[model samples]
Target: MVMQTDTVLQKMSEDDFMAVFTLGRKLGQGRFGTVFLSVEKSTGREYACKLIEKRKLVTCEDVRDLRREIQIMRHLNANPNVASIRDAYEDSKAVYIVMEFCSGGELFDGIKERGCYTEKEAAKLVRTIVAVVQGFHSLGVMHRDLKPENFLFLHHQEDSPLKIIDFGSSTFFLPGESFRDVVGSPYYVAPEVLQKHYGPEVDIWSAGVILYVLLSGVPPFWAKTEKEIYQEVLHGDLDFSSEPWPVISESAKDLMRRMLDKNPATRIATGEVLSHPWVRINGIAPDKLINS
Candidate 1:
């Protein structure tokens, strides 16, 4: 399924990526790519280089999606909360994208290590996530996939800055525009996305799911199968009557309810979510930890 070398060069750069930077240990891997810790030859500065194999791009659509992702990353390069793309290069075999290296691991791993967080801590995290969503929407982009795994800390410090990664499923949109693609992780996917008609508000729903998981250590909608999970997401009620719920702050729950609203129109927007008392800085969310 490998594309012709000339064709790939037409879409990407013909220059040698290895000549400028040396690839180090493997950082991670995806369907069509492997991310490596790379160092620039001249400066010795470190970066993450995502090397997408041309052979795995089996179809024209796959190639288009990769290009779109690169463009989107470049578009949001100025945002401090986003992983900045430093450069892109391609050879006959692969496309290499150099980006900011996040030393700390995924937000999911961080949460797993901590077991659970206080309402205030969760609120602080959610505020950062929502701010990213708000910024993306302001720039006319919709982050079709918003999940904890896509968020990473800049360093291992407790107060390290959070940055959003993976724009592969993101796309630009106009005000009032609707997208029909059903793109997102199963647990975080909005009900409207399952129905095949949705907009940027889908990101809010996913963020709500993340918030819920952060406070409770589990997703609000859970089932043994993906189909059943979607059913729960579509019809199940929010379980504020559970164990941890009794101890969690009501202000946090109120914001959750509004953000996870099934109706996109009625769902709280990023601006309003940021302004919510529980989410705003020094707001009402308590510092007490929830039961693990």
Candidate 2:
């Protein structure tokens, strides 16, 4: 029987989640939702259960978008850069999405734990990320939000693969259509996206921002407000002056400049980005973009 849900369940009340799924600790929570760590009853495999509150849906568009996120996930099943949804269900309290469990947590957490990455290490990470985005482009899904928080490692390992999670901000496009939604993390959002003229190129722009943050240990802009951030991103205010930085090469900078180009049409091609001098190296262990 479906349990009454008016009273929100504390993650500790494992019974609220039911024994059907092994609900573990709270991974994350926000204004719209909370995600619990859980394991599937059938497979005995761990997974992340993202719970978005239904009462929080103030707009029809939000409901449409929530449905879109599920549709997009289904459409992108095996894509390397996408998080796989094992199951989905909705109750009076929330919409529950079960996904592959990534114990290593967000890439931002890793970066915070360990200062930053070397240029070579940063380059390898960026390359793996680009490959994942390339796969997304092929699937017609746009992960408008591509910040460090959205990138997660599968588990704790000397070398763990990064998994791109959080599709709530994703948008899908049919052939020859332009997406007009203003979505994404402000710091990593492209100028075109802020201006509402972006396409898939915006994903590459966000990826460049990820590269910049991974190597520099700080975002390009340190603004305190939304407007200031857009201004900085539009003007390309990126400079590596921090002490530990490895004096990033002009080639890498060139790639970044191209990816973060204010003009969407002028942005660098995703397929070609993999061959960029900074990304073409070998020897470092290759990390898969998606776990499953």
Candidate 3:
């Protein structure tokens, strides 16, 4: 049944989600909800179900944000790199979003278990990530959070495709649109975001931070606390004089510098990032082991 709200169409079913799918195990939990491994009763297919409690949505803004998230996910349903929503069911007390289940685990975990990382591998991953950013920006959406944890491999295989899994902080945007809300993870958030005014460039900065961590195994801006992390993000220097960075190719460093530029005006655009020599498909990023 369709529940029409003022902001967006809530294509939510009033029936019980358990009637169609059986919840198996807890996958993860957040402020307002929990994700569970679920199995469809008819097909025996598995899925990740996000159950959001209506009671947790105490404020109107909270409800609006949840609706907006669903709308954005529906809007980006066609992108292969993003996790697709399978079905949405809402009852009196909660909303259940059934999504494509990713069993390969988080990107960083995959990287760590591999025991070896190279610039070529890093470039390939960054290419996919930047491509996702480019697709989102072209489609007028901005992913406020772009961190390593949000990317999960499709299966438990060496060659599994990476898929982005969160849209909680994402929103639609027009060209030159500036958002004032400071909404994002501290380590991956852009300096402009902390200042309360930002555009899609924030995504590039976050992706750049991820690339930095991928290469060096540490964040460019590190601090003991969230406040300190923000301070470092706003005022800290990009460290390339350290261990693995010394062996990393100059081209990769160049892309990082451009993407992490403090001035949003000078920050690399999504298209430019994909086209960069290091990030481009089969570009010049060396195959030498970065963590060696």
Candidate 4:
């Protein structure tokens, strides 16, 4: 069931609040907040409580961004592939956003630890992400930031479910509407985003970068500085002659090309990505090592 977004900010009685949940170790920190592992005393359920200091939101824009993140999270309730908010509380000092705890950690760490992934494994991971993108598109939500660091596995299992987190960069768009905000991580940012006009296709570009990195263990566009990286992205230089390229199938490369097309007008849609042969292939390799 979908939770009410407005009620999430309502102040409750002290007897029914913070005392119920035991905050644990520091999970991670972002630009404006820190996430802590929290557990409920009554049910023993675990959650990630994101604490955002009110003092940091010194301007109107800062406050709007934080509220946008919470609003987007609350609206996309109960999606298996997207993180859901369990509760939200605010005090004079900070705003606490309690969300589902993803124990398997960042997809970036998963990729880094393993070094690389096979086509089948990469396809499975991309499929989950594309499915979530499709859902969000239908709901008019745009996950402006789509990268390995934003995805997390639900458990420590090899085939655990993947969940997308960090909605601070997400925003809603109407049909045929677009955004001009130049937001998103440098390497994953689309050309149109740099041009200051873009739609949901920016996400497809970022996802392509993730797929490329999963198979090659590196980014498609890389340089020493953010400026150089953005320049490479604008130039749209893609390399497939590396060590791993010989092993990857042409179908996979084809999808990446379509996803990372310089023109957003011609980029592959999320629905098309899900049906691509590279993403649809499912194989059983008994000898393949399962890397979590």
Per-model root-mean-square deviation over C-alphas: 1.6, 6.3, 2.6, 4.6
Q: Ranking by TM-score, best first?
A: 3, 1, 4, 2
- Worst ten in a row by lDDT for model 4: 1-10
- Candidate 1, residue 63: how far the Cα is off, in Å: 1.2
TM accuracy, model 2: 0.84
Angstrom error at residue 97, model 3? 0.6
- Residues 92-181 of candidate 2 have per-residue lDDT tens digits of 566677888888878867655555345676777788888988888788877888888888888778588888888888887765677777
**lDDT value, candidate 4, whole model:** 0.83
Put down candidate 1 lDDT per residue, 73-156, tens digits, no spaces: 989999999999998898877889999999989997876677766888889999999999999989999898899989998888
Compared with the true structure, what per-residue lDDT tens digits does model 3 show for residues 176-241? 888999988989999999999899999999999999999888999999999999999999999989
Q: Give the C-alpha miss distance for residue 291 in model 4, angstroms.
A: 13
Model 4 ranges with Cα > 4 A deviation:
1-17, 111-116, 281-292
Q: Rank candidates by lDDT, best first.
A: 1, 3, 4, 2
What TM-score, over all chains together, does every model reach? 0.95, 0.84, 0.95, 0.90
| Superior candidate under lDDT, 2 versus 4 | 4
Q: Model 1: runs farther than 4 Å from truth? A: 6-14, 112-116
**lDDT of every model, 2 decimals:** 0.89, 0.74, 0.89, 0.83
